[model samples]
Target: MSLRLAPSSKPSTAGSASVFDTSNSYGLHDTMRFGMRQIASEVTAKHPLENRLAEWENTQDELKMNLARNMYGMHAPIKMAMERSLVIKARGPSMLPRSSNLGLDILVGKDETIDFEDFLNVPELSTDMVDVHTVMEHQLGIRV
Candidate 1:
């Protein structure tokens, strides 16, 4: 997940070093050694980065669930006002962008097309914009 440059070395005191010499076996060996250490520490070792990523993922899921719950609650009053109404459904956030989906039920007889841009302008909802895009693609049946 990262690229690191090899540490620079001091120029040789003798005439052994050349400006055009691109082949530095010692430098290559040192770079490989550094790479091995990096891999051992980051990939093989028990690092906290993975744990932090998991925690962040859980928090995102919780936020998405909260948003969905609030949206469902908001729909309750409108549901009671009329027998049926336009419903906008958004799924909770997921690890994969394509996993999140939205279901919008247009049951009202309205002449104008209601844009959801205004309603979904909230920061919490916009955080998972990829989810929205996925849902819209699913609804519209447009293959990416």
Candidate 2:
């Protein structure tokens, strides 16, 4: 049988308190925060190792390329091409004859500097040029 108690008629003077005490909840929150921070630190610790490895690999590759370039002279094809393009070609002998008399040239209004454009249009060999084989056979008496 359940026991039943009668209600008290006297008024109580004590202040009412909550069934669940939330006054000390801040300590639990702090503990949880600290645990999460520790986990986060541990998780991120491995990233630096991977990042460092990648950086080291890049540095090594760069060093190897530089070493190869130093050991072998002009090994790069593009560099060679650039150097070749930058080189100034030596000019060939002038086809036109020069006069010994400076006074005659000055009177004729002929400038000392030859115009390269004038000879550019001219053919290297004359129109009446003979074949090499014919000249060799006729002059040297050599049989083909």
| Model 2 agreement with the true structure over 29-63: per-residue lDDT tens digits | 24332322233432433443454554553444445
Clashes of each: 0, 0
Report, for every candidate in turn, its global Cα lDDT versus the true structure: 0.42, 0.40
Q: Give lDDT: candidate 2, residue 107.
A: 31
Clashing pairs in 2: none
RMSD to true structure for each model, in Å: 20.0, 38.3
Best by lDDT: 1
Estimate the lDDT of model 2.
0.40
- Clash pairs, candidate 1, are none
Worst 10 residues of 1 by lDDT: 1-10
- TM-score of each model, paired residue for residue: 0.18, 0.19
Candidate 1 residue lDDT tens string, 59-82: 443454455456687565445334
Off by over 4 Å in 1: 1-45, 74-144
Could you tell me how far off, in angstroms, the CA of residue 92 lies in candidate 1 after the best superposition?
22
